[model samples]
Target: MKESITRYQFISLIILFEFGSSIIVGLGFEAKQNAWLFILLSMAGGLILYGLFTRFVSFYPDTPFPQVIQILAGPVIGYILVWGYILYFLYISARVLRDFTILISQTILHETPLFAVSLLFMIVVGFACYLGIEVIARSGELFLPYVLLMGGLFLMFVFIMDLPKIERLEPFFNIGVKELLSLVFPRGVSFPFGELIVFAVIFPHLEHPLNSFRYGVIGILISGIILLIISVTILMVLGPTIAMNSTVPLLDTISLVNIQGIIQRMDPIVIIIMVVTGFFKITIFFYGGVTMLQYLFKLPRRKSKGLIGFIGLLVMTVSMLISENIAEHLKEGLEIVPLYVHVPMQMIVPSLLLLLLFIRKRKIQKK
Candidate 1:
């Protein structure tokens, strides 16, 4: 059976995927006292980069990056590029799995074995992948609206808890233009913005390839705005120092909501939202990894699913090995190595591919 997913479903997955990992806790650390400002700046830059990427995709409608590289750079060079991307995707999927497992163990199920949590997540995600992209996209579509609504309610409650402090957001540029710029455009035009590179892999699967640009841009914008609002809420409610120090600022903030003691202890609801959002996010990375492997080795049609599951199990194991402490993982991920690893992968390589494609197109026209 030829299964298909609509463009909206894909868009929802992308949105949820981006929001999953760091939207709540990431700002708690990196952005700190000026979390909202940092997010706004990051979003603005992210949108610009995303626009550039989408334009590149639209330039060659239905052609994924791997194919584009092959045509422009020739098979030898293209295969190398594809191989690098495959490895990158595998690494990212592993890291995200580990991070999510850590969160669940620390907060919700303290008694659960880490391996058990990782295995259960793999089983569920593996099943989704086995069902194919269409099934995964449908799940994203079904859950996205509800997740958004729940997120909205959470924000509303945050506002109710601390309305007066909303003004604390004023004096917007007080963090110094340099610091703000650093947070937004860190490491010379790279950072989180470069993450839009994954769209290149999935472009062929988009229902409306032409409109992928629009939808992709919209997805980043929506997610960015939500992140900005979330950062602001956490800052106003928890204050700068505490919010920065908190492992789960949103959860901490939610725990403070009393509503006459009846509506208290809503942290569980936030955890539910985390699980849902994280699932979609991790699935996208996992899908990207699997697809890359299939394309790289030219695996048999049906065997790709089984192979991908085995690969995912390895990824989970690697995640466990990467760190003994959550703080160390965050330190390495944020401060030590992301700029070095992600920047070249996300920005440098793709930009080179685009350039090569343009040069090849010119040569063909000249002939």
Candidate 2:
């Protein structure tokens, strides 16, 4: 709770978190070969949504999101809203944990119990959360370069093998104005970009809050660009239909790398990216939930140590119980969660908070 992170660490964490399960599942594939365009428009929407989130934080830059809610909404209403976000964060942490669990069970550990994989992964995540935000941020700073290198290598090998078929992207503008715009708003922006709302907790931990906010925006832009490149690569290589249909398009793309057989079977690279980025994603969500609890109850640093471990178990259990299988999980995430959960927590509530803050500021000025 007493920890402080550097600006570089903040940017690295944002990039790593954004690159989480979203990359594994891919985004904007509804546009088919022109999924890149879909992603581009979504990133624009995400940036605007992010500006709204950060603007709310700017009113109370020194405070964490939980406290900001209390100040803006008053204790009764803020208490309810803060608790909602707390559960929301933990629920999402569980969801992402389930995401990696399914990926590992399907790809690497076919025979392994999904519960076993989640437990092992959650152990490391729990330990990291126990350490605090500074440690998490530092780990992200250390790993961001490695992630970039591995991601770059994957892209490089695809071209080296001459796999991309630019022709697959023919009739590029086939998407209607309505269809493209439909995908961009709630679906495209919500999943990865709107998820940055969790960073409101982490933002208050930064050593230089004002400057670090700028880095965070830059981090989102960089992640968006990386996502765009990956989307285009998948479309070019696997074509629109295949990329859209595949559960893990990037993994499928990497599986196609065959250079004289020696440079093939690069599934490990995708797995590594999934594990590393998923860790950051789940841990950040976990941390946000725990941070809210700590702030709510006024828990000391000593008490939060136990809370972290307890919450970790809760998240793991909820992950398994959240859905019947991967199909159900993805279905809920795609259709139900965005409209029902994400819009309220990420967009509606925050927008309302901003409005309240504006009124409060004017009243204070009048006084």
Q: Best candidate, TM-score-wise? A: 2
Q: In model 2, which range of ten residues has the least summed lDDT? A: 208-217
On residues 1-367, what C-alpha lDDT tens digit does candidate 2 reach at each position? 3579988899999999999998878988878866888888888888888888888656676888898999999999999999999999999999999999999999999999989999998899988877788889999999999999999999999999999988988987998899888877788889899999999898777787766557877998899999999888889999889888899999999999999979999999989998899999999999899989988889875667778888888999999999998788988988889889999999999999999999999999999
TM-score of 2: 0.98
lDDT (C-alpha, whole model) for all candidates: 0.74, 0.89
Runs in model 2 deviating more than 4 A are: none
lDDT digits (tens) for residues 134-179 of candidate 1: 8888898999998898888888876676632855555555677776
Worst 10 residues of 1 by lDDT: 185-194
Clashing pairs in model 1?
A: none
Instruction: After superposing candidate 1 on the true structure, give the runs of residues whose Cα lies further than 4 Å from its correct spot.
Output: 1-3, 28-33, 187-192
**Candidate 1's C-alpha lDDT?**
0.74
The estimated TM-scores of all candidates read 0.93, 0.98
